[model samples]
Target: MRDWLIQLRKERKLTQQQIAEGAHIDRAYYAQIESGTRNPSMAVASQIASFLNINTFLFFPEHLSEPFTTALRNSPIIVAHCDLELRYTWMFNPHPDFNTDVIIGKRDDELDHNEGTIGLMKIKRKVIETKKPIRQYVSFPLSDGLITYDVFAQPIYNDGNQLIGVATVSTELLT
Candidate 1:
């Protein structure tokens, strides 16, 4: 979501400040939306989408299949999916330490800017670029200390067999 917004905004050679101004929103507030800290309301989403010259539906994951959504919801593992741009489109049962509400519409880099995050981002990139599945151990810092998980990521394809995104499941958390 944010990735698409950012990409579209960049394609138009617009800055966050500019878009914010055009949308009649505070730059700081707009930054929050771009950072996935806060979600925009439908009206706000519409406004932003219009300002960016993109469809508002891009902000929603309505295109995802119901069976996939159900699988994610029913999975006990922390399941998530991100577009080819690495922006999260869907997530379920995220880490307890994270705010699930803020996970969607975020890029891997937006979530954190640490070495751990960078490593994870690299792995995600590889999965997308190679169109392969990967299973690895990942550790990231938490407020208390650190947590680790076994992460499995695979590329997602549409009906035409075109890669669209990456799906991941992270479980077996170790503190």
Candidate 2:
């Protein structure tokens, strides 16, 4: 049984039915969650956490560690997460000329207002709207020169299953 979940529900004076309704799920499903007979998806967990006034991360295991960091550090591909507004939220192994400081919280247009950045933004917007993944070759004009990359972008969701933004992996294509 999920003792912690049960304890929290009791403390709030909420029954399984109430939580299920609040989370837009069936009571039996919620009951299964409480009984530990079923595992909740990220979206369901987020809803339950919201009802309990807690962070959704509580439902997930903390597995990100040194290995993850090390791999990302050594990776050649650039990885980034952006908000719905297309502003960068997190990035790893960015281009040689650009650092985290220049990327985070900034949109592509903010970094470089050109045809290339415009095209990139359009691709990201399409992914966000369609809730799908897209892969294309994109070019960016930098101070050094124009660099082309194979970019893959997909919709990113919050724990609530809400589409929050897009995550991207970009690898420079050598001629």
lDDT of each: 0.73, 0.79
Stretches of candidate 2 exceeding 4 Å from the true structure: 1-64
Global CA lDDT computed for model 1: 0.73
Q: Write the per-residue lDDT of candidate 2 for residues 1-175, one digit (tens) a residue.
A: 7666676677558999999999989999999998889889999988886565444544553334667667776565888878788977667778777766456556899877988789889999999889999999998887768888899999988769998789899988886
Candidate 2: worst-modelled 10 consecutive residues by lDDT: 55-64
With a 3 Å backbone cut-off (N, CA, C), the pairs that clash in candidate 1 are none
Q: State which candidate has the highest lDDT.
A: 2
> lDDT, candidate 2, residue 20?
96
Model 1: per-residue Cα lDDT over 96-166, one tens digit each? 66664465556767878776677777778999989899998887786767777688999988669988788
Backbone clashes, candidate 2 = 0
> Can you tell me which runs of candidate 1 are displaced by over 4 Å?
1-76
